[model samples]
Target: MLPTLAQTTALIRHRRSIKPQDLNPARGVERELVVELIENATWAPNHGVTEPWRFHVFQDEARHELVREMERAYREVTPAAEFREDKLQKIGTNPLLAPVVIACVMERHGGAKIPSIEETEALACALQNLMLSATAAGLGSYWSSPPLLDGATFRAFLNLGPEDRCAGLIYIGWPREGLNWPRSARAPVAEKIVWRAAAGA
Candidate 1:
């Protein structure tokens, strides 16, 4: 049976990004649940069925691999004079804060029937699905939205084609004991929506 409208709406509204530092490092997201989350992501709608989203999952000690690659990428891009040790420290330790880190990738299917933007939007929907799944599971997940998320260097480290895009990294885990999320509020939709009715017949 499908979820009731109230249940569905509540799930959507409660889904929020929990920062990596707010996650419990000692706990781990089970492998089976991770697979289920990814399955939910794949069910996202895609034009022409391009299915252009790809995921690289890192857990346990393996999550360090992503951190290491990210640090290297930072070094490659940021000049030594401008490099901040504190930022590199976060790159090295942040992934360890979460039980799992999923590297979100977007592959551009060259000359596909639909525009690349459609595929990108499909990927966004897929990420939303995964996030909602995590929320429903009572797990906290964070998706990094940095402007320069793992770029070419880190993509090559992940063995992705150069043309593929490094969207972001999703950190998933249980919230730490003291991690309390404040109630979230949204502005009235009336300020944002503009609907036009039909002209007089």
Candidate 2:
């Protein structure tokens, strides 16, 4: 059965950006649940049915390899004078804090016919779907996109094609002990919307 409008609205509004540090590293999310979340993500709309999202999941000790590559990419991308030791350290450690880390990618499968922006938008929608599903499952999730994602070293690590692009890294895990569900506020919808009516209706 479909969720009621109120339930749906509640789910969307309740979703929050939970950071990796806020997650419980010891509490592992089940493989089946992870697969279900990704499956829901695949249902996101795409123009011309050209599903363009790809996920590279890093879990357990495998995350260490991801950290190595990320650190390498960070060094390769950042100029010496502009580089920060703190940022590099965070890149090396963040993946280890979450049980699951998904490297979301926007693969260019729509070709020249469908614009690249459309494919990227589709990936963004898919990520939202994934995050909402995670929220409903009581999982804390964070989407991290650092400058290293744009580096050639990282792209080559993922074996992405010339036209493909990494969207972000999604960290998924349960909240640590005594962690509270965060509250957030949004501007009124009326402020952002401009309604139009048929003339003289």
Candidate 3:
């Protein structure tokens, strides 16, 4: 179900990045809620009715393969001097902590009627929708795009074409810790808004 405006705003304000380790293993989110979240995500505004978003969901045993791929990519990019075995292990283990990992992708429509940049902006809005839905559903989510996994290698692994772009990875699970972070302050609305009038009208 969709949250009311006030409730949605509150969720947005309270959302924070809960670490993978900080998530509760026994308190996984149900598949039904995940479907609801994706449904809500589709409500985001898209210019010219181009629904460019695609998702690759990873959970349970699938997560192990993802971690293995990510570890391989990480090792390939990391400098040998700075690479620690423990850190690599942690990197591989982190994804397993989350019950689900959502790979958000943008499927580009070549020769799109709308501007290309607007399509990307629309995808950003969809991403926010997903995040807000997660919050409203009582699931903690962290959106991340590691540099090593941002290129063709990752896209190929996920079976994305030349036009498809990897937006980010949404890590979803139950929060182990309470929502305790202070809300980030926003810029003054007056400074951002302006009005124009005819001269001497």
Residue-level lDDT tens digits of model 3 in 48-69? 7788788888888898988877
- Name the lDDT value of residue 196 in candidate 3: 77
* C-alpha-based local distance difference test score of model 2: 0.95
Query: Candidate 1: TM-score?
Result: 0.92
lDDT of each: 0.85, 0.95, 0.79
Q: For every model in order, what is the number of clashing pairs?
A: 0, 0, 0
RMSD for each of the candidates: 1.8, 1.2, 2.8
TM agreement with the true structure for every prediction: 0.92, 0.97, 0.84
lDDT winner: 2
**Which candidate comes out best when scored by TM-score?**
2
Report clash pairs, candidate 2. Answer: none
Candidate 3 or 1, higher lDDT: 1
| lDDT, candidate 2, 1-201, per-residue tens | 999999999999989999988999999999999999999999999999899989999999999999999999999999999999999999988999999999999999998899999999999999999999999999999899998999999999999999999999999999988888888898998999989898998
Q: Model 1 clash pairs?
A: none
Model 1: weakest 10-residue lDDT segment is: 145-154
Query: Residue 163 CA error for candidate 1 (Å)?
Result: 2.9
